[model samples]
Structure formats: structure tokens, C-alpha cells
Target: MTRCRLCGSTALESVVDLGATPPCESFLAAERLDAPEPTYPLHLRVCTDCWLAQIPPLITPEETFSEYAYFSSYSSSWVEHARVFVEDAAARLGLGEDSFVVEVASNDGYLLRHVVDRGVRCLGVEPSVNVGAAAREAGVPTLTAFLSPETGAAVRAEHGPADLVVANNVYAHIPDVIGFTQGLRALVADDGWVSVEVQHLLTLIEENQYDTIYHEHFQYYTVASAIRALASGGLTLVDVELLPTHGGSLRLWARPEEAAGEPSGRVADVLAREKAAGLQELSGYTEFSARVAKVRRDLLRFLVEAAEEGKTVVGYGAPGKGNTLLNHCGIRPDLLPYTVDRNPYKHGRYTPGTRIPILPPDRIAADRPDYVLVLPWNLRAELVEQLSYVHEWGGRLVFPIPELSIVEVER
Candidate 1:
């Protein structure tokens, strides 16, 4: 964009241009296959002033989240991650029956269910109607609305200031970063804790995780930039924890400035790491574009060689990141043929730009394909165990990110 979304600065440098592609989560129905699909420029830039990396606000949250297809409960590891977070947060924050908990963008009540089980009052503020309905059906109180300054204040007034506000994997989804952060401030008590988990830009660059950049993710944050973003809404970063989720992520603990005394040593430690990695300057981003090009070349080469050898190569998991990888590499059904997923909503649909069919998880076993190209490589550990049956027929699993590697499962 001409101006940075966060700092409003006119100086924005190129990080990587992923070319134009449709929304990553936009799966096409059979009826719409013949119709035309729209695409937008997927260029990511970093602001020279604030060092915040972002893409243009080409798509709005309403367009994507109104009836979102992603369900957090589909990933067993993610659900367990949520459960453990709830347990730890409860014990750490001294939450009990009297504590009020609120989770923004909570999908399908995966995390809040643990809070509900503990008999604490909790609510999920989600924008997607389908997932929010699923949350309600699971006995979790849910509000089907987007988070804003006014919305957060209303929640605080009606239910009283929340003791704990959990926002996981959603800090980068909203375009209005300032407004969204203000909403978080409004929902939390003056002394309450706000926990946010987002993909770490440092690891994203070091690990060659460019596929994570998509239209839905508006911005990527380093600890330094994240500190500035938090202060924009009067929230102070008090603690920071590095997590292994989403390849690599940061768990930020914040509070209102009045109660946020001094940041923990971890904050400085992360900032130091970011500085050493050259993220605070322009040098870190200079080689990213070249590295990204290498990844695309390597993946396309593998698919071509596999085809020539008569080795069938299909995909596993139709995640949004997978769509980014597919569209960037210009892969179609000719190369990938089809993919399988656990979410039933995508069973009969096709990936937006690539037009690859999505089938059920059992199809891999039924067809016994020679090779299964895994799209959701972030869930490598959990998916490997789930797909160990591939070993029965000598079928192998392929991972495309951080480097392309093939695994021979031994059951």
C-alpha cells in the first residue's frame, strides 16, 4: 500500500510479492466451478518507520469470516493445545467460579469449553455464524459479532470487566489493528490479563515460512513492533513467551498501562533476538524474496519429476496456507490432483484458485496413492501419527515447507 496501515508512513519497502491470488479460504462449489473467480495482489511490505510487515487491506473480515469454513476442533493437536492453555491460564491467574473469561474470535468453542468445564463464567465473541453456532451447541456462551471498541465496551458493561481475555491466532486477522487493540483494552479489567498468540515474524523468515503470508493475515509482528502496537491502544506488554505453534509464535501477556508495571526479562530477550536477526533493519528482508523463489522452484521440480516417474502425488489437508503454496507455485489438479481434509464442510468443495478437489481423510487409504504431499506441514507431528496407515502399502508422506522432504512411515 502507499501508506503503512499501522504507522501511516509513506515509506514501505518490499518484503515479498506472492503474486495475485484469490482468498486462501475461498473454496469453490461444483456449481461455481464454471464461474469466474477474483484475485488480488498478495504483496507484503514492511514499514520503514514502525517495522511492521503488512499487506494491503484488499479483503475485509466480513467477506471471509461471515461463514468461515475453518474449524479449530478438526485439528486434534490444536484442541489439546487449547485445553492445556486453559488449564495453565486458570492456575496462573487464579481464575475460578468468580472469574469472567472472554475469548475473541473463538472458533467452535475449542478453548472456552475448558473454562466452561471449570464452572467459570465465559463467553466467546466470534464473527463467523456457522462456527459460533457450533460453539453455542457445545454449551459455550457465544456472541456472534466482530470485536470493536464499542462492542468490547458493551461486553464489559453487560458482563462486567473480564478477568481474562484470550485472543489466540487472531491478532493478525483484523485490518484495523489500532481499533482491535482498543477493543481488547476495553474488554479487560484495569488489572486483568490479555493473552495473545500470533506467528512470530522472526521464525517465519528464518524457517522459510512464506506460505503463511496470505490475504487473511493483515500484518506480521516482531516483538519490537508488537510492543509499539500494544501501546497504541493503551495496553502494555508485561511478559512474552515463545511458542511452537504455527511453526513459531509469540504468546504476549499484556494489561492496561496502569497495572502493567514492568515488562518481564523475556520481552527484552526476544527484542534482542529480533535485533540480532536484522529484523529491526532492512537487511533481514533482502534475502527473503530470493529464498521464497527457491522454495517455489524446488516444489515445482519435485512435482514434475514425480509425474515423469509415474509416481502419484496428491495433497493432504486443504488449509489456507496450502492454497497460498499451491497458487504461488501455479499448481493445479494436473500436479496435485486432489487433497483430503478432516473438515466435512470442505468435502465436496474445491480449492479457490487451484480448483483441486477436496475429499475425506479416508480417501488416501482407499486410493493408496504413491505419495501424499502434506500442505499443513505445521501439524507434521500429529498428522504423521494419524496417517501412519500409509505404511501398509508403502505410501510415503511429503512435506513442502522449510525444505521439501519425504518420509517413509513405519507402522
Candidate 2:
């Protein structure tokens, strides 16, 4: 029996079994495709004790993130998101030149650049050397090490405690939930706050976002479970905000337990909402597998019908989430001939399990496919706007998640 990573409970109930899947971000080179690739069981479980939804760590962190391919600067909307966050956070926290900010899992300095521009001292803790080098080139000093309790203590010794520590979209990626939260506590000043952003478990089930389930993500957290995990590290939740990014994400503001701060009503409000949705009970999770299976069947039917009709279908954005959707649905190059991406690192490569070639955005206009499958459905609006020229050829966009639907482009 696999124990819960957070609470160490042995009573883990099965939620959804996605069979075996490769690491979502593991793009393959042309030569490597001929060789066998490693895949792990993509199964999720819920702990009755803590109510934390998680998957067992099949691959080690070194194997998954040492040479990361995803870069934050590739998406214009993501960069804008970072800029807005830095602006709002700096203003809200009263950050100045004297204030020190540290970002964990900082990718390419997409967010910290704004903090540096504001004259606040900032440091980034990044594990991927390639991405870390990019951040350094952009004038963001970064330490190329994983954020563990030991490393966090070393950072504190070298640079002093941070006035504000930001960990956006990285809370779920960590395998050691308790250790990671403790590390955050170690790095933050006594009075400073730690801001963590994670995709809400409620939104994941409501929207049928099963594609977000990949090997790198160790846990899916609800507001209540998140509060429990943070409290284990001697942190208290002070505030919470729901965000629209990544389907629906929750940004949590927490401080050391000894710190003087009252918990915001939003925290209780969201916790109550989760309870109303039956998230506190096991029955709330039992129906999810059926919903996910329906999505897979519906998407496959749409793709098979399109193929039989001799329609040329291609994919947009080779994101990790897209890989999960394609691999889970057993899609290959025949269904989606190829995909386009703005990130140069993924342009010449192929997706891990599906083996679909990834090309540059210019390929979409060159091919003028009859239908473009938007793989990263969360960014549908941005993609539709960028690929608007496809409408000139009477081509429509297809979204596979939350039910397969065809969207007509407005001329």
C-alpha cells in the first residue's frame, strides 16, 4: 500500500487510473523515438485521513526536472500574468529596495524581472540549469538547486531571510509536500509572507480537466487540504484568492504561525464551498472516473469521424497538458498530423508518448489545416486570436476538454 505523501496515511482510495504514461514534459528527439521510453502508472488516490488527492512518485525529481524544457517566457499571456502579479504583490506587500524577494522554481525569470525592475532585491531558486542560465542572462541572480529544507537554510544563511517568497504553480509539482512547505517557512522572514498558487481541485473535477494529471504533478489540493499541509510546516493561512489561470487556481497567502495576522474570511468561504460540493467526503471523488472516461470516449469519436471525412486536423501548443490528453485518448500522428508551438525548445521535437511532431507556429498557416485542435484548451482565447488567419480558409478550432466542441472563428 502506498502511503500519502502529506499525512503518511495508508488508507488511500483509488480515484482514477490513467494506465501507464510517460512524463508529460519529456519531449523526445527524433533519434530517441526508435528506443524504448520509460512510462509509469498514472493513477491518483485520495487519502481519507487528510483528504489530499495525490499520485505516487513514480519518477524521481532528478529524472523529471533536471533538464526541463518548459520555459515561462514562451507564452505572451503568461509573461503578462507574471508582470501583473509582481506589480500587485509588490504594491500590496509594501516592497521596496530594502525588501528582498525570492521565487521558488523560478522559470526563466519571467516574474522576477518585474521585481528587479521595481528596484527590489530578488533571488530565484531554479533546479533546471538551462532555465537557470536564462534567468541569469536576464539579470536575475539564481541558485541552481532544488528547494529542500537544507537548501532553504543555506539560502537563508547566504542571502538572509526573504521579505516575500513567491511559489506560483509549483506547489503541486513538489513530491515532499511537508518538506517543501517547511522549506518555504525557513526562507521567509518572521513577518514576511509566503504566496503559493496551485490549481484548485474543485475546478479540476468540475471542468473535467483530467489532462492536468501528469507524472510531474504529485498532488491536487483543495483549500482545506492545502491548509492542513501548510499547518504541518508551522504556517497559517492568512488569505486566499481564486484566479482564472490554469483553469482555476488558488493563490494562498500564509505566514509563520507565530506571526500576527488574522485569517481572511475568503479562506473560510472557499472551505465552505468545498464542503458544499462534498469534497470533504469520499463520495465526491468516486464519480470522477466515470466523467473522465466519458471525455476520452467523446474526444476519440470526434477525431475518428474527422479523419474518416478526410479532414486535415493539426494541433496547437505542445504543452504538457496536451500530451496527457493525447496520450490518454491514444491519439497519434494519424489523428493530429503535427502540432505547432511558440517555444523553440519543443519546435523540433516530438511529444513523449504520442510521437506527434511539433513545429513552429508558421506551419499552421503554411498547412492551412481544415481543423486546428487547440490542445491547451485553457488558453483557447489567446490561441484563437493568434491563429485567426485560419478562419480565412474556413477552418474552425476544436477544443477537446469539457466536452469536444468546434468553435467558429469570427471574421
Q: Over 4 Å off in model 1, which ranges?
A: none
- Each candidate structure's TM-score, on Cα atoms with residue i matched to residue i, is 0.99, 0.99
Q: Rate the local accuracy (lDDT) of all candidates.
A: 0.96, 0.91
Can you write out model 1's per-residue Cα lDDT over 1-411, one digit (the tens) per residue? 799877899999999999999999999999999999999999999998999999999999999999999999999999999999999999999999999999999999999999999999999999999999999999999999999999999999999999999999999999999999999999999999999999999999999999999999999999988999989899999999999999999999999999999899999999999999999899989999999999999999999999999999989999999999999999999888999999999999999999999999999989999999999999999989998999999999999989889999887
Q: Name the top TM-score candidate.
A: 1
Q: Candidate 1 at residue 160, lDDT?
A: 97
Candidate 2 C-alpha error for residue 235, in Å: 1.1
Where does candidate 1 have its weakest 10-residue lDDT segment? 1-10
| Each candidate: RMSD | 0.6, 0.9
lDDT of 1 at 286: 100
User: For model 2, what is the error of residue 278's alpha carbon versus the real structure, in angstroms, after optimal superposition?
Assistant: 0.9
